[model samples]
Structures are given as C-alpha cells and as structure tokens.
Target: MPGAGTSINALPKISLHDHLDGGLRPQTIIELAEPIGFALPTTDAAALGTWFADQADSGSLVEYLKTFDVTTGVMQTREGLVRVAREFVEDLAADGVIYGEIRWAPEQHLTRGLTLDQTVEAVQEGLEAGIALVAQAGSRIRVGQLITAMRHADRGLEIAELAVRHRGNGVVGFDIAGAELGFPAHNHRDAFDFLAKAFMPVTVHAGEADGLESIRGALFDGRALRLGHGVRLAEDIEIGREDEENTYVTLGPVAQWVRDREIALELSPSSNLQTGAIAAWGDDLLDHPFDLLYQLGFRVTVNTDNRLMSNTSLTKELALLSDAFGYDEDDLEVFQLNAVQASFLPLDEREDLADAIVAGFATV
Candidate 1:
C-alpha cells in the first residue's frame, strides 16, 4: 500500500531505537560549533553529511566511534542541546513518525559544564517545543527520551537516576549503549538493579557487536524490556533445507526463549551493514537476516539507528527493506505494531498508538 514518496510519508511510524546525538542535522552541527569554537571536518552541510555517513560506513566500530566525538563535542551547552533536540523531533515529526523514543547519554554531554539535570531539562524543552511546532502545523506527533549510559563509562547509576527523576516529564525509559563487545551489561548491574527497583523500563544494546552471552547479560542482568540491535541473536538459529518448497529452522535455548517470549529486536538495516553486525550473513541489505527473523516470527521492528550517520529516515528504511526483501504494506505494518508493542509507553498509550498506526496505514 505504501508505494513510496507521499504514500510512505503518510503512513504513521513508531521509532523505538533512535539515537539523539546521532541524528543531528549537519547545518545545526556547524551552527552550534561556531559559537563553541569547535571545528569540524567540513562546514558545508552536504559535505559534512557525507563525512558522517562515510565514517559510519567504514565498517569499523572504532572509526564509527570517532564520528560521535564531533557530534558530542558540539552538544555540551544548554543551547546546543535544546537546539539539537528540537530539530531532531521536528525532523521525525515531518517524516511521519507519530511516536519516537530518542536515546542519548547525558554523561557524555557534561563536557562544557552543564549539570545532568540541566541537560535533561534543556532537551525536554526542545522536544516540547518541537511537539508544539508540529501541532501548529495541524500535525500531531509525540516523542519520549530514553536516557542512555555509555557501557564503557562509569556513570550508569547517575544516568538511571536522571531517567527516573524525569520519568513522567518526557523521559520514557533507560538504556545502555556504546562499546558493546568488552563492556557487558553486567558492568551496569548497579544501575540496572536501581532501575528495576524503581520499576523503570530498559533496553540494552546487545547482539550488535557481540553474541548470545551478551544478550543473556542484557536479559538477566540489565533486564532489558527490548533488545537494542539484537540482530546477532540469529546466530543461535540453525537452518536446514527441507523439500523443494520448504525449510526448517531450529532455535537454540536462548533464541527459543527470545522468540517464545516475543522479545522485540531493533533491527537497523543500513546501520547494521555499516557496522558489520551482519557480516556473517553478508554485507548487503539483501543478505540481512531480517526476512529470516520475520519469517521465524521474531518480534522484528525496523529503525534508523542513527538518522544522520545513516542518512536515512523511517520512510527510507522501510522503502529500502521493501526493495530488498519484496515486502508490502502488511510487512511494514507488522514492524510498526512490533515497535508499538515494544515501546515503554503505558498500556492505554501504546494501544492508542497502535490504533493510530493501523488507521493511518489504512489510508494507503
């Protein structure tokens, strides 16, 4: 039904795994950097955009990590945070994202003397502003923040507290990101325990740069309600060809539990290829295990991990998936429903979101 262009633009979307700093507009980066005396690889918007996407395309996690240094470098003050956050939501709203969860680590934004509380408040203000701007245009959209802690950093507890402190104030959930290989979710046990006691929802970045053991830590230790970039969970699956028209899949205990429990996997098509998470399968989107996981009944929700770095939007992501996997409106709707079910929003809110998505898709 979504035939591309305005059709896809009209379909409502729910983004569960998007990074805040990673979605900054290039012009915003240059404008914000000028006041802070921060220099970038390029000042021209087109060239700068290419630079971010190229760095991410290096297929090296270390190189990808370097790209963020420029983004985080600019988001150190109240003004920069608010401006970036405002534009981020506005862009998502314009792209037909009815509901979104923007994730970023406040600890990383403390370089230029902003208290964690101030940074959160500033971002909240920006999100609210963006919401108002959309409303003024006769369009309705909502966004919630997922307060993230860098796995390699030592500020998990503090960030978790920050998320809880702003629970009903635009903040939706908590997450642990960055350096997923060596720094297991167990490293943030104290923070996870604190969030568990506080009864907050969490999502952990696992199965992206690591395997099943990392996913186990995300579940048992971090208590992640959703698995961030859990593409590698496919490693636990064994496939064998049956007759001419059939095939069979056998899931290991962990993968079986995940599928049985309906754990949502935030599968970012472009970003996964860029970061080499799906290298075992292949490098192209066509080679991704997304279709396999979908056919296996896994809770597979699509996302643009980093909008700027990937130079993508939810519409483009869906179009690319459709092109790569020959999917239709039904498949896209499944992704939206999975994301809605996996969102940290309350029961009534999530139901409302799902209903809206269904109705919006009906138009196409």
Candidate 2:
C-alpha cells in the first residue's frame, strides 16, 4: 500500500483544471512583456510572482479575478502565447504531472491582433514543443487544451466552434469560465447546444462563486461533464452530529445528483481558499469539504486552478490536502485515478494513463 512516507512529487499525477494564462512563470512574463511594451506592476520576477499571490489572496472571487488582467496583458501575441504555453507544460512535467488539461480563453488572448485560430495554433505549437522537450529528457508527459469561453461574453458559440475545429489537434474539451455569479450557463445556451450536437466534451466553472442554482444551470443547461472548483456544492449538504462518534450528512438534490452520477469535481485547494470559494465552510484548508466529499465517494479530483496566482503545483496541492486530511499515498493515488477516469481522452488512452499511474505509484 502506498503510504505518507513517499514523496508526493514523485507520484504520477493528472491535472484536470489548471489555467494556462494563470500558470505563466513570472520571469517568462517579464521576457514576453519586454518586446510588447507591456507595463507590469514590477519587472523583478520574484517580486512579480509575490504580487500575483498577494493580489489573489483577497477573500472575494471578483477581487481575486482582477489579477488575471496582468497575466493576460502580456499574452496578447503569438510569441507570448507560445512561450507561456511551452513553459506551462514544462512546469507541469517538472511537478510530476503525467497528464494535464490546460484551460484558457482564446478570446482573452486576441487583444494584440491574433485571430482566435491563430491563438489556438500558437498555444498548440508551444504545447508540442514542451512535450518534445520533456521527451528528449527521457521523460514523458501529455497535455491537452480545454478551450474556454468567458461566461460574461457572447462569444461562446465561436469559441465552442474553435474547440471543435481543433478537436483533432491538441484541443480536447470546452469550458466556460470567468465570473460565475450573474452569468449563468444559460447565457451561453446556444454554444452549449452546439457542443451537445457536435458531441464535444465540456466542463463548467460552477459552484465556485455561486450556489446550487448556478451548478444546476451548468448541468442542465451547459451539460458540463466536470465542475471547475465546484466547492460550493457542499452548500447543499446538511450535517448533524448524532453523537461524539457518529454524524449524519444529508445531501440535497444537487449534491446527490453530482455524486450519484460520478461527475468530477475539479477541486483546487489553495485557489479555493484564496478566492473564498470555500468561505461558507471556513477560512482554512481544514474547513474545506473536500475530505467530506471524498469520504462520501464523490468523484473528487485535485488540481491547481492557477499555479502562479496560488503559487502552487500539483505536488504541493496534494501535499496540502494530505496534511489537512491525513491522507496517505494510497489516498493520493485514488485522486489521480479519479482524474484519469474523468479525462476527456478516449477509452484506450485513459486506460494507458491509469496503468502508468499505478505503475508509478507502485515504486513509491
């Protein structure tokens, strides 16, 4: 059995919810911005990294989102997107991520002059370069793009089409992100409808800044195969202590359906805490309902929503969860397997990924 004595970084992992723009290296940001005449809060890479973390530490999701303006500011060109995407995959490989799905909105990266297709192609080239670099080092890592649309925008159908157009390329799935409160998934019904007809896989940013109603829209309206930081689904759970040793957790329809249907929850521990996504429960990691959901047999998979903003990696996220819940290596492996099962990859590829994960963990 895998145990806590093994190093978490050495374990093979799958990242289901990492954001591409949000994972840019500070030094890379500085280099990329230099050619574009972009103004940053600071040019010093280390200081700039700290600034991102500090800005995102605010307890409001809206306030936390303001930091993305800076990251996306530098990624408005083909070169910038390529460099950022390449380094993003290298970072994932270094962190022991065997498979990862990088999510970003192409609409957000078109400010400088790049068309949506150009942005996707640029990022795909970078991802391929990064994968090749890893392979050259005698290591293997696979990554796919989850083309995202900003929920507050009306470009969902266009973005969904872009994702489908590149389905045979590096693109694997679609996602809707950005402010989840007022803009329900129904706002992008046409896009979701198109994706449903095209048979494209989807994941939605629900139950993060909103409650059950928003999640319901993501399911019934957006048809999300997975939930992006769906921590607030816990709001639907009612807990009562029967005694010192016994407790009762009553699940609402939303929570019950999510659990019963085996829909994956792309939980980001640090990002969730920083954005107040788990505020209904408490302020610290201990207060997070991740352990509760996991114990209850929900398809809970761990992730780093924004590595730069949260200053975390897949390894660190796993370590933090382990520390908070006293989870052992076996528990971590279970989480990795959950991600593999939920990935948009085809059946044989997912089976291969699962086999690789089990083999990697066996050595630990």
Candidate 3:
C-alpha cells in the first residue's frame, strides 16, 4: 500500500483537459497586452490573477467563459501565443505533470491577422522551446496540442483540416469547445466526419453545461474518444437504496455505456463547481459526483481545466479531491493511470507514460 505521508504534488500526473489560453501567467498577460494597447482591469500581475479567479467563479458556464476574453485578447499575436504556450508547459512541469495536452481554438486566435497555420506553428515553436528549457534544467516534460474549434462558430471544418495538417508537428488531437448548451456536438458534424475519415482522435466538451443528450451527441456525432468535463453524466445514475453493506444504484444507458466501454471522464473538480456543472448535486466540492463515479468504476481522470481561472494547479486539484474523498496515494495513482490510458498518444506511447507514472508512484 502507498504511504499516506507522500506529497500529492510530487506524484507524476497527466493532464488531458488543460487549456492553453486558460493557463497564462498574469504577468505574461500583462506584458502581452501592453504592446497591443489592450487595456486590462488591473495591471498588477497578482491583482490580475485574482481578477480572473473572481470573474470566473460566476457559477454559470456562460458567465464563467467570459473570463477567456481577456486571455484570448492577448493571444492574437505569434509572440503572445509562443510566450503563453512556453509558460504553460513550464508551469505544468513545475506542477509535476509528466504529460499534458494543451487545448485551444485556432479560430479564436485569428483576430489579429495571423493565419491558422502560422498560429499553430508559433505555438509549437514555443512548446518545443519550453521542452528544451526543462531538459536543460535536468527535468523532463512532454506536451501536445489538442487543436480546438469553437462550437458556436462555423469554422469547424476549416479548423479540423488545420489540426490534421499539423498532426506531424506538435498537434495530437482535435476538440470542440465553447457554449455547450445550444451548440451540440452534431453542429460540427462535417468537421467530425472529416476528422473521423482522417483517423484523428477527438474529445468533446459535453456533459458540462449540457446533459445526457449532449453527451450522446458527442459520442455519436463528434466521435469523441473522450469526454471533457463529463461530470454531468452522473445525472444518469439513480440511487435506489443504501445499507451498511452496500449501496445500490441503477445506470442509464449513456452512463452504462461510458462505464462499460471505459470512456474516460476528464473531471475537473474545481472548475466543475465554479461553473455550476455539479449544481444539480450540490454547491461544494464534497457534493461533486467524482467520488460517486469513481466508486462506481467509471474511468475517471482528474484535470485542472483552467488553472488560471480556477486559481488551481493539478496538484491543488488532486489535494482538494483527497481532502474531499479521503483518497490516498494509491487512489491518486489510479487517476493518473486512467488519464494516461485515455490520452491521445499511441498505444506504445501510452504504455511508456503508464510505466513512468507507475515507477514514480512506487518511490512515494
């Protein structure tokens, strides 16, 4: 058994749902915003960080998403994208993330006249630079871009092509994000179909602001290999009765399929509570269905969806889960293994990551 004295921050982890734009350092935002004459609510880095957290804790998904305007506003230039992407990797490494997939929409970064390809190349350059810096410092970390398309926009097919175009580069997967309620995954069917034909892996933002129907559309229409913030899938589970020896519940078809197929749920506990994704259950972290889903054998993986917005790191999120559910080192290892298995990497690469994780955990 793993020792209880181990530090959660020291555990090697994998991040599947972290956002490139959402992980910016407040100081980086300040510097990036200056040359462009983009005015901010506050110029001080610490104050700006607090501003993001305050603005994002709106308890409404739409409102919470508004905080991204400030971030994407600064990322419209190649310099901005590179710097942000570099810092994103460095921060993940500092948090002990062995592997991370950074997701961001190329469509959103085109407002400053940079073409989609240029933006991807720029970000890739930054990611490589960050990786080199980590190696120079005698530490190691790996990252990939999950090229994303805005669900509310009509550029899905274009973005999907762009992702496939850069697959040999740093891009690893495709995703659709933004406004999940009205904009179902099927809205991007052409793009999804293109990706499916190209054999590109996908993960969709479903069961966050939406429900089972949205999750079903993601699985059917988007062909998502994983679900982003799929916490709402818990709604499909109905508890009948509980005794000292057992607690029995029934699973709806959607939940049953997800569980049986082991489709990974990228559960960001802090982000879920801030966006009210788990409001139907309760307002607190303890109220989150993460424990419920994990106990029921769902392939649940921990993530820090937006580290800046949630004012959290992967370590902090895992610590919060431990505090809420009494999970020890062994349980935390399960989440890391789950994330590694669900990652977009090839089977051999996934096995390599799993081995690294297991070796790291064994020491602790």
For each candidate, give its TM-score against the true structure. Answer: 0.98, 0.98, 0.98
What order do you get sorting by lDDT, best first? 3, 2, 1
- Expressed as tens digits, the lDDT of each residue in 244-305 for candidate 3 is 78768999999999999999999999999999999999999999999999999999999999
In model 1, how large is the Cα lDDT of residue 116?
94
Q: What's model 2's TM-score? A: 0.98
Error of 1 at 182 (Å): 0.5
User: Worst ten-residue run, lDDT, model 1?
Assistant: 1-10
Total backbone collisions, model 1: 0
What is the lDDT of every predicted structure here?
A: 0.92, 0.94, 0.94
lDDT of 2 by residue, 81-111 (tens): 8989899989999999999999999999878
RMSD of each: 1.3, 1.2, 1.3
Single out the weakest 10-residue window by summed lDDT for candidate 2: 1-10
Provide the global lDDT of candidate 2 against the true structure: 0.94
Residue 275's lDDT in candidate 1: 91
Clashing pairs in 1: none
